[model samples]
Target: MASSPNIFGKAQADVLAETGTALLQIKNSRRLTLEDMARVLGRTDDMVAKYIAGEAEMGFVAFRRASEAWPELTEKLNGGAE
Candidate 1:
């Protein structure tokens, strides 16, 4: 099967990539391992890795879990000020 081009284009892709990197930074700052993140989000390590790699989008529930686990994540995502 063939895939269609991404309608969201480069800008959205860039944002997702930056988000992934930021999420990784947050995990690092928390001194968390991928396993720890998986437990926090109720996801498998592979899925967590994909979220941190920008290969998969975190759903609202996962996002909520992540934000709950790291309140600073919400601030950082909202542009580094709360």
Candidate 2:
């Protein structure tokens, strides 16, 4: 059977939703700010804000830096307790 385009789009949206929520939660739990997250990703505050808002998708390098800086973020992104 051929997959519909909506299926792929929904999957991507789900990933973005999960990632954005995780980023927000982790930032709050660690008492971090947008500047802090941006520093980790080597991005601007607005860029990190976009990531947390689910307005932008974070690339692999950003994920790597975020995970390195916060092990909790890694677990959250991996769906917990990996």
Candidate 3:
């Protein structure tokens, strides 16, 4: 049997893309590598990359850590982060 379709579909993809962009911007602003972001979130570098690539969902704890890591970017992103 096939897996059920994602309920949100396109909307979900849009959110992921926006999230990836925001994270990328924040990382660039901090001059941080994927490893740095992983360290900040207590995750692995590949996990950070997956989140950035829109292949993983960002957990609240990770979001909080990122916000703490770069408050300015987080605020900017909240204001239509694209």
Q: Could you estimate the TM-score for every candidate?
A: 0.78, 0.81, 0.76
Poorest 10 consecutive residues of model 3 by lDDT?
2-11
Candidate 2 total steric clashes: 0
**Better structure of 1 and 3 per TM-score:** 1
Candidate 1 accuracy as TM-score:
0.78
Residue 59 shift from truth in candidate 1, angstroms: 0.5
lDDT of 3: 0.78
Judging by lDDT, tell me the better candidate of 1 and 2. 2
lDDT of 1 by residue, 1-82 (tens): 9553453454556656666887898888888899999999999999989888988878889989988888888777656853
Residue 62 C-alpha lDDT in model 3 = 88
How far does residue 43 in candidate 3 sit from its true spot (Å)?
0.8
By TM-score: ranked, best first = 2, 1, 3
Model 2 lDDT tens row, 4-59? 24434467667777788999998888899999889989999999998888888888
| Consecutive 10-residue window with the lowest summed lDDT within model 1 | 3-12
Full-model lDDT for every candidate = 0.80, 0.83, 0.78
